[model samples]
Structure formats: C-alpha cells, structure tokens
Target: MLRSVLAVALLCWGADGAVTCRNENDEPVNWYILYKAPHLTSQALTGLEYVYIDSNVMRKMAPSTDNYKDIKHPNGVLANTLRPLLTPIRSMPNNFGFISYSDQPPGCNAMDTFGHSKGVVMVDNSGPGVWLLHSTPQFPFRRDQNHFWPESGARNAQIFICVTLGYSQFSHIGMHLQYIGAFPFEHDIPLDFHQELRDAVNWVKSPPPNNLRKLISTDVNQPFYSIAKQQSEQPKVGDLYVTIAQLLDSDLQVQTWGCQRDRKPSYCVSGIHKVLNIKDIHTVLGNWQPKHDHSKWCVAENPNNHWTCIADVNRATTQYQRRGGALCFQNQRIKRIFLQVAQGTDDCSTLNIMDTIDCEPDPHTPSLMG
Candidate 1:
C-alpha cells in the first residue's frame, strides 16, 4: 500500500518545482497555513479538522471557520505532507529529510522536560525544511501506524504553519528549535534527516552567521512553583529578529512581545526586548481554537503597525503562570489575511512587552524574599 502511494506521489510531483506541502486536494502548493477547528462544541469536526490557507492555490484569505467550509473536503493536510516520506530510499532525493517532532512523539520522548512546543519539520537538501508548528500532541503516526494523525488529537483547537526555504534559512530555524530542545522525531530520525540539523547547527554557530530574519515563538511550559523556588532561573529562550519591508523602526519587534499576556518570570526569559499589550482585533482571534487555544501566534491589530504574529503561549490567569511564545512578520499579504480572522483574544494583558522584561518581586520567589 505504501509503495503504491509513493508511486502515485512520484507521478504527481512537478519535478521542476520546489518541494512543499500539498493542499486539501493533494495538489502542489507553494506556502500553506492550516487552522484546525477546535473541538469546542460537540458538533465540531473531530481529529484534526483543517482549514487550509494556501497562497499559491487559494489566494483569498477566508474567515476562521470550524469545519470544511474552506475546502470541499477535509483530507488530513499533515497526512499528505508525510506521504512522500514513505517512498523507497533509492527513489528518494538526496537533498531532503522529514522529522515529526511533538511533545507526544512516536514513543515516550520524555519531552516533559522541554518547552510546550509541538510540530513537524521536513527539510530537503534543496532548501530549508518546512517546519509545521502545531498544538496537537501525539500525531502524524509512524509508518507502522499507517502514516496518519490520530483522532485522539481532535479534541482541541490546533494551528499549523509550514514555511519552506533554502538550507541557510533552516539553519536559523535549527537555532530556535534547539532553544526549545526540539529534536527530529527523537532518535527515530533517518540518516538522510540527520544532516539537516547537524548542518544547521554547524552553520549557525560558524563564524559568518546567516542572521536570517524569522520568528521563533514557543511555550517553555515551566512551572511557576519551580520558578518561585531557587531551583532554576527563567528559561533562556532566543528573541526573533524582525526585518519587515514596511516597518522601519527596529523597535517594532519589541511591540510584538507586548502581545504576551503574562509577566516575565525572570530576566533570562525569551527575547531581549519588552512585551507589548496588543488589543488589536487581529490578534484577538475569536476562540481561535476549540477553546481559544493554540496559544502561540502573531497578528497585526491595525494597519499602522503593519506587522502580525501568531504565538503558542497565553497570558490568561492559568496560562500566564505557564510558559510559551510566538513568531512575528511584516509581510503585508500575510498580515492582512490573518487580520480578517481577528475574532477575539483569549487572554489580555496590561503590561507592555518591554515591561515584562524585569521579574516582579514575589514573596514566593526565594531570591525575592531573601
């Protein structure tokens, strides 16, 4: 069955074009964004309900819906993304590899120690791997499981963003993923996929840094109790650099951080700048997921800002005490599109992105008390 699937996929590839994910119809796509309708109400679709936004295939951005109103049918997009992997090694291209990373990976990944990051990555020698960031836990099962995302993941709202580029760009992605301690499907990664990360780390740490512009949002998922005690300093995560064409000020990146609703646990927290208080409707997506979920993402509240970012962390009473972050961008088309879905914001914050830099003196914190 797998062999036949690969045969059909090989026949489908344009060969002349770049390697990317397919759309709802299994057609070639340049760049695509998927929003999995959350299982909020009992009527919502179950098991990875996908709302696809493929720029190449579907240019018009639609409102964030809870079902297959966007696509004629809901053919698991992630499943199609992993299809080509099953193709025989000999028939494989030397330039590409796929890694399915998640908090709930194929095995007991023991990822509890890491951040609250979950997603899939596929890189090719041709360019940087496409990182599909999402909220699903155990998903995109192993070959033995028939290469599919399980229904167990359909209980909540989820989001997946896939970006493809050259090897140089992926090196930057590697640096960010490393910050969160994300690995390619754990030790189960194949040899072809190994070089992607090895090369990325070596390249990023090399003398001439790529310094590529991209967003690296994530949730560290550290407990407030541990932070209150002297057990560990705050998570030392990296800040993403923004170089959008319309946004002139370097300070814009600082404002995007404002969207984070929680206060910074310590100075070692992610990003060197401050977090902003974003009330813009764009970021205020209407219960964007099953229960106002997929905490990390960026969005442009107004045209004056000309920037948008969707993150995976929330600053609500419960989540503010947790850990997470998001990536931002100045791309007009993307910014405008996401703005349309600006339904509502799950949580809100009064602290500016910059203000969150310093840790609030808390009696629970041993250092603060001492």
Candidate 2:
C-alpha cells in the first residue's frame, strides 16, 4: 500500500520534532483533507487522481472512497507531506520556514490583482507548522522546482486542507497572507520568523490594513478559523459567502468555479445566513457537472451547524469583485464529508423567478467574459 505508507512515514520521522499533517496512512496529522478528482474523460487522464482524509480518518467516521490516489505517489500523501519542502536547501534545518502562495503562479503570469489564493506555509523555528490550504493552479513547483505535484494541476477538481499549526500559528498565518493579497511567487522568511512572516513575503508590494481578517486557532489548541479578503476595486461590504454566512451562524452550501462569468445566484437573502449555490457533485469518484469541478468549498447547512470552509473565491460576479479567503472548521467529521458531495442547488425559487441563468459552457474553460 504505497510501500506501507512510505514505511509508516519513515517511522514517524522526528517523532515530536514537529511539522506534520501526513496521513494517507503516512501517519502524523492534526488535520487533512484532499479531494483532487477531475479530468473527466480523455481516456486515462493522468491528472493524478485523489481522495483522502485524516485526523485519524476523521475520528473513525471514514467510509467515502473511490479508492483513488496518485498525487505523484512516491509514497503519496502529497509525496509524504512535501518531503521536507522538497529537500536540499543545504540539507535544511536552520530552523526552517517557507511560504508559497499562488495566484496561478509557478512559472508566472496570472496575478491580475492577486488574492485568488492557494497555499503552503511550512514553518518550524522550534515550534511546529504546516498549513496547506489549496485549490491548485500551477501548484507546489518552485522550491527551485524540485517539484512536488502539478501538471497544470491535472484539469479542474481540486481541494486540500492540511493544517497542523504551531509556531504561534504562523502569526495568524502571516496575517492571513496579508489579508489575502497573497501572490508570493516563492518565499523563505527567516530573519527570525514572524514579522507576520515578513508581511506575507511582501504582500504584492505591501497592502494589509485589512479589507477583512479574522482569526482563532489560538496556536493549535485547534479549533481553526481564519478568514481573509482583499482584492478590491470597489464592492466589498459582503461577499465571501456573505461573510461566511454571518460568521458561521450556519446556512451555506457553496462550491465554486462552476463555469465562471458573472455566476452568483443563491443567497436566499431574507434575514441573512443562506448561501446555497452547489449544483450536482456526487463524489466517490463518479458524478460531476459544475463544468467539471474546480473545487472551492463550503458546508454547514444546519445539522447543528458544524461549519467547514476551504476557499479561494468564485461565487462569481467577477468573484464578488475580486480577492479571496476561507479555512474554517468545526468538524462533524468534516461536516459529513462536505455534506455528502452536495448533489444540486441554485435554488431561491429558481432565482426568485429567473432573470438569467444559462451556465453549462466549459468548452475547456477560458472566457470568463473578457
């Protein structure tokens, strides 16, 4: 089984030396989630299929499975939790630290205004760390390109969660990547760590007075929560799943990038809290649509509100006028595995009597309306 999960993750390396989040049987984990599955039909599409869960199989709730895995399986679990930042920075450990943002970064050219976000944080200056929020776009490929995974992220469906916090939760994940203006093509953050990780590696030339920020994970006593937003040209009082359904008071369903362009529809608006929008997913490696999933997430439609986010914008209206955030938590087994892969949505009485709803495009996605 992938070489016995890389021989029990190399016999649980450095036992308590920190830096974790490895499970796919590779052990160590305080959190984990990964979905990946997309590339629907081109025959044997090698988009490195996936599906995994952790925190000890969500404390034994586990069951969902299509039996996938292959994210460059050299003892997978994303290559054994990115083999110590793809090794060789002089054999590492001068109290390491890292960052790796992305707005489609890899070889570069796609940062428009930044903050569509993607992550990788690392850290370990004597305390622990791992944070890996994601939605993939030219991913994990620039630690001198020692490569970890990415072939243009194998066409669509993506999602990742990671989390293992510590070193003072990376200064609230470097001020939530400087309130999401995140575009650090690569980073190292060392000068004795936290200056909000050198202001999130120079948030695209400085800019974090906050368009939104929220924190709460108290350095991994764990209950995680983080929000971040910024990418404005105007339009920001609410959007980001209506401020995550009024800050987790519940009611949300979301899932994003469903054939972009203007999108937004399904926020039932009456007294707040109700974000809907999903529209067929049914996973276990099967059903699709939503133009072949580009995975942004949400969940917490009551059932005693066990929240669960994992975002990077895309309810679209030009992504709520741009920029993004999300990384909530309050797991009820990760909110029933993202509420059983949703199934359908877009209600609100069909958008309160329709005024335009067409969607269904994906001729291999491109035109987000100029």
- Candidate 2's C-alpha runs over 4 A off are 1-34, 37-74, 85-91, 98-120, 123-131, 134-158, 161-173, 177-191, 198-239, 243-253, 256-265, 268-276, 282-284, 288-344, 350-370
What C-alpha lDDT values do all the predictions have? 0.42, 0.68
lDDT of 1: 0.42
lDDT of 2: 0.68
lDDT of 2 by residue, 240-334 (tens): 87777776777888887666656667877678777888887776556665656677888988888788889887776665555668888786777
Question: TM-score, each model?
Answer: 0.59, 0.32
TM-score of 1: 0.59
User: RMSD, each candidate, Å?
Assistant: 10.5, 18.3
Model 2: lDDT of residue 171? 83
Worst 10 residues of 2 by lDDT: 352-361
